[model samples]
Target chain A: MGEAIVVTSGKGGVGKTTTSANIGTALALLGKKVCLVDTDIGLRNLDVVMGLENRIIYDICDVAEGRCRLNQALVKDKRFDELYMLPAAQTKDKNAISPEQVRDIVLELKKEYEYVIIDCPAGIEQGFKNAIAGADRAIVVTTPEHASVRDADRIIGLLEGSHVESPKLVVNRIRPNMVKSGDMLDIEDVIQVLNIDLIGIVPDDEHVIKAANNGEPTVMNPDSGAAIAYRNIARRILGDTVPLMPLNQKKGAFTRFKKFLGIGG
Target chain B: MTVKSNHVTIKGIKDGLVFLLDDQCEFSELLNELRYKLEHSHQNILTGPIMHVDVKLGMRNISEEQKTLILDTLKQKGNLLIRSVETQGCVPEDEAGSSLHTLCGLVRSGQVLRHEGNLLFLGDVNPGGQIICSGDVIVVGALRGMAHAGADGNEFAIIAASYMAPTQLRIAEIISRPPDEWENRESSMEFAFLRGGTMQIDKINNVGKVRPDFNVFKGV
Candidate 1:
């Protein structure tokens, strides 16, 4: 059966949407048929960041209501053949859908796609529940900050209780300068608080912002550190144990095995 | 599954109520009967002195589903002393976060309800359920469930019981228990108070000094 993965973070502005877009794109580039669902419902961003906002004629609500077929609501990514996005309706709130319904939709999608990556909202409220109800695994994204880490811990507790234990961790936006100066929590501290295996450690790359502004995922950029991290994470999802990339250390530290990853972990 | 204990004697125990039902009848049928009787025009189940119920099952015992139905039926009958206990991977500190009562009438297992103000529990607090407070935690009936006061770092919090014997008891960080050596001791009226960051519990005596035997007559 296809695995349904959810990208979630309890605190807002921890790059959940950005991770969702880039990770889904990276997975599709790996030749896995992936469907990205923006389950935030009202305050949606998968469409906007994907730069497919203007092309949307139908949203997820229309599919749920059966006004359109699932195929009709699916939007193809221009860059990847297998990647598709089901955008949320800005006009509706989270309560417009049911958890059972989300589960049913994910179950149906499992039959057709290799992966269904859901973009969860920023809180532990209805939106979060709606996004994760059908997920088999989850990726908790957090900044290297105490508040975000604490909220991520709480979300991990909820996920464990809600039958989605063993969620992987993604530490986004690591500014090496600040971490070295002890002004911010480093990767080790975040991992200790979260107590989970690390999947991605994305550096604060300006290339990501540029790519987003240009409607392209940073993962599409060959030299971008964030893109490389996302690609590694996507490879790790395929059962490859890619070592985490060294940050601010010598680039040639793991040079022998680096090219063997071949643009992956 | 039966109503706990092979022999159930429906009788008065001190000022409390105890209905012992033998483990023979289908729990659903028994609960349906209780609900019907309580809702009956002549029989007012809520007005009587609150009762304590102990279900001792035999052999296969009652299914988790049966126990849930019984608890729900008791709640529908106005008030229930028997609370649902979810013993799976929980701790004593969880008692601070349980309301077991209804802000909404629906109480689900594994869901914790924490209120900071003076608390009133309209329903039974199940075993896994907790009712911890910075103020007084008042269970309107039999308190066979777990409860703690001054959970938000309040040391003066005192825990009162209609019928006192919890699987675990806590007031703030202090934990109280009947002496570990005495497992068979049962009680009806007891109170636990925090003394020097440790919990000390004693039976409340209406006449003289607090007596430990006062808890011997069980079921609130």
Candidate 2:
């Protein structure tokens, strides 16, 4: 059977949905059959992030409650033939579906898909439990802020207690300039606090928001730094040893020329 | 003339009366002698105002039932009050209930590691993580979280860490200042202890000086 990975962060507003959408799309682009499951229930946003909100006929609740078949509830991605999303129910609360039901649904999807990515909801509540119930592995998403890192540590402890094998960490929204200026926490600081294996680091890019506004994930754009980071994470998940992308961008030619003339660096 | 064995002796002290019970005699014989002394021989002393009686059992270990029997026998006398019953050569109650517990893992945020006695942690205690111990807390790694040593109010307990930056430190009931007050970046190992009801931080090397008994190891 294929492996199921859950994307979770204990705190809210830490880019769990965005990372899930991008990772799922990247895996599909890498010639793998990927199924993205949105376990947020009433607060579903993965469908909108994947640009599949308009095509959701039946949701995860319907499938769990036996109102429809699993395939019927899945919304196929418009861009990639190998990518499909099982949207969450917008009307039902997180308690509408149990962990066992989510596990069964994920097991059924694992038989057909090569990779099943579950987009977990924020907070260590019923939604988070349901998301990680059937996951073989887990990806803990966090920013470099103190609150996010603290919450990520809490989530890592819970995931380990649940026996999810050494969940990898993905530090999102890193600003290299702020880090250099000593205003924000650097990648090394976050890693030292969380004390987990780093899977990827996505630099803060304006294109992530711009692409999300257009109902497309940032991974669809090849030039964005966030896109490259997500692709590297997908490749790492596939057992590829890709080097970490450099966060510091090289100076422009004019700046270099100015620095050569002893004006500015 | 017959030689009488003195199984119990009563002494007059400044505060009250001291009862020196012979440890080498049989418990029943000692009880009988104590009863006879208090009822007949020492009846004149017991006729006055309430006198505090201190029972000193030297080199004798007795169970709770036997101690209660002594207390009851003392209570039978009208003007006698039992002050303290002390035994020699036995560990104190607080020390007897404590032990050393070793833990090797990350104590992450929202996770609490509570132990009844001393705790020896070999991993980092991240922000929001906590360690509540009754005896002492010793960390071989970074201590960035809250650690409450002497959770049961043993003020002599201490907290030691290699990297001694912590959000908060508590010894007994006294809480440390906020993180801003003692934001130490010192590379040396440090420990926290309570002195005169106030928490103090010092280098770990001086622990033996602060608490002489802290050096449990003998010579090399």
Candidate 3:
């Protein structure tokens, strides 16, 4: 059976959907059959992020309500044949489907897919519960801000209380320059606060937004830093010991000159 | 006139009247004598202003029903109001409030770990996490969250942490200032306590100086 991994963040707008899309795409690129499930229900966004909105004939709600077969609800990705998306219904609320129904759907999908990725909605509500119902593992996404880190910590605590294994953390949208200047919380600080195993760290790359706007996942662009980070996370998810991507960019002329003169290490 | 055996003796003290019941006599004889003494005592003693009566059950193990019977007999005397019942020897330690409890794990945000007695947590308390203890609280790891020691109103309770940067610290009813005003970014271990109704944070090394009785070691 395939493993179900839920990508969640307690707070909204922390790139949970982007991370899900990129990771699922990267996994498909790694020769794995991946199925991405959007559990946000009425507030669906994963279908759009994956550029599979037009292809969604029947959603997760239709599959759960027995209106359509599981295969009929799945939308094939235009880019990767191995990647499929189970879109959430735009008209139905989260209460339309119970956790048991979601778990059943995921179990049915797991038989065909190598990795079933569930995109959890923000907040610890019914949507979040439904997303994590079938997940064997969890990935908590957060920004470097204190608010995001705090919410991530809360999500980690809740995940521990559930039957899922200990969740890993992904610190997204980290500004390296801001961290070096002591203006923003660093990776170490975020790790210290959450106290969870760090799976990956995605830098604050402008290309992520551009790729998302174009209805393409960042992982499709091989040159983007965020894409590379997502690929590394995908490798780690496959049980590969991929070293974390370095956060520091090349030094400036002044800084290199100072280092050459032995003014600072 | 026959020599009367003193089974129950009443003595007057500054605060109240002490009813010294004999420990060696049979309980039935003691009860009969006590009843007779209260019934035949001087009228002035029984009719005057209310007198606080303290019953001292020295070296006697009495049941709840028997103690209630004694109190009822005393209450029959109109002017005698029973204040307290005293028993000698140490009380049993069956209560969880008097023992130490150890918890080993991370206290994450939005999680509250409440305990009745002393708590020895072997993990970090992240921001927004809380620990409420009726007695002392000791965190062997970092304490970045809120800790309220003496949650049940014990003013002598103390909270110690290896890396003490708590967002809030409360000892009994007194709460410390915000973390920004604490100015306690020292590298050494620290502990918080209440002194003179004010919360104070000090190094763990000085805990003995502040509370000499805190040490449990008598000697080797």
Candidate 4:
């Protein structure tokens, strides 16, 4: 059976959906058939991040309510032939469907796809319960902040109760400059608090926002630092032992001087 | 199958059935719904000669008057045997139900763990999580959450951990804290217990150094 992994973070705006879109895209590019399920319900944005919102004729709610066939709700990705997206309903609240209903939909998707990526909503309410109910594994996304790490620890606890594979953490929005200056929490600080296996460490890059605005995943840009980090994460998820990305890439004094002179940075 | 009500949710627990009261519903509506469920929808499990049900209030700070309103409603209904009423923050008296509970994993934020007896945790307790027990509390790993060792007012209860930097610690009715300078003592293992009606902390290595009068063990 295919693995159904939920990308969840207890705190909002920690890049749960962004990580879902990019990782799903990266896995699809690796020749794996991936289906991204946006379970955020009313706050659906995975479709937009994947640039497939306009193409969503049917959604997860429609499939759960038997308003459409599961195949009809699967929206094909424009960029990857093997990738598909199951968009969540924009109008329906989290309570529109139960956890059992979501579990059934994910089980069905597991038959045809190698990976069923669920984009979970924030908070540990009914929405979170539904998203995790059908997940075989979990990817908890967090940033290098006290509040975010605290929330991530809670999410990890919840995931552990569900008996999924120990949830791997993805520390998003890391600024090397801030870590060098001792202004932000480093990977060690986050790992110390969470005490879980680390999967990826994505540096803060403006390319992620630009790609999202264009309805494309940052992983599509091969040269972006964030893209390389995400690609490594995708490989790690596929049972490949990949070393973590070095966030502290120190710039030489000559290179810094050249950048100050407006030369190629 | 049991009834599913918006005001109250019922599920079969180990001790008995648990009635969860949703805080969002109107108080009157909640009472009406609770009465209706007990009368009509309890046919499936309530068919037994004797039944015990525990009521769980939602995870919110409830007032005294509200607690009485719920208790009065359940008292009036003689059909189901009301076992106990579990509030959100109040630790139950029977925390010593299990002689000892050994949890092999970390306790995360927003999770409340209560035991009737001693609690032996094998992992860390992150901030925002709580462990309340009527007996002693022990953690093999770091203890950084709220721990109430004497929830049932047992003054002799002690809380021990490898690295104790708890956000809040309590023994019996007293809340004592060591100096902030003691935090981050990685290699030191410490235990906190009540002595002369005041909580005192001592390192495991220096147990014999404590005052002889304070070393007296109380009867369980």
Tens digit of per-residue lDDT, candidate 3, span A1-265: 9999999999999999999999999999999999999999999999888888888899999999999999999999999989999999999898999999999999999999999999999999899899999999999999999899989999999999999999999999989889989899989989988888999999999999888888899999988999999999999999999999888755789988898999973
**Best candidate, DockQ-wise?**
3
lDDT comparing candidate 4 with the true structure: 0.85
Give the best candidate by lDDT.
Answer: 2
lDDT of each: 0.72, 0.90, 0.88, 0.85
Writing each residue's lDDT as its tens digit, candidate 4 over B60-102 gives: 3466887788777766655568888765432233442336778
> Cα deviation of B69 in candidate 1 (Å)?
54
Give the distance in Å from residue B201's predicted Cα in candidate 4 to where it truly belongs: 3.7
Residue A174 shift from truth in candidate 4, angstroms: 1.7
Per-residue CA lDDT of model 2 for B157-184, tens digit only, reads: 8999999889999988999955574664
Best candidate per TM-score, number? Answer: 2
Predicted candidate 4 versus true structure: per-residue lDDT over A90-125, tens digit per residue: 998999999999999999999999999999999999
Candidate 1 lDDT by residue in tens digits, A133-159: 999999999999867876787687688
Better of 2 and 3 by lDDT: 2
Q: Per-residue lDDT tens digits of candidate 2, residues A1-265? A: 8999999999989999999999999999999999999999999999988888889899999999999999999999999999999999999899999999999999999999999999999999999999999999999999999999999999999998995889999999999889989999989989999989999999999999998888999998999999999999999999999999998766889988998999876
Docking class of 1: incorrect
Q: Each model's TM-score?
A: 0.56, 0.79, 0.78, 0.72
Better of 1 and 2 by DockQ: 2
Per-candidate TM-score, chain A? 0.92, 0.96, 0.96, 0.95
Q: Which stretches in model 1 have alpha-carbon errors above 4 Å?
A: A249-265, B1-220
Interface RMSD (Å), each candidate?
8.9, 0.4, 0.5, 1.0
Which 10 consecutive residues of model 1 chain B have the lowest summed lDDT?
A: B206-215
Clashes of 1: 11
- The parts of candidate 4 lying over 4 Å away from their true place are A253-265, B1-103, B117-120, B176-187, B194-200, B208-220
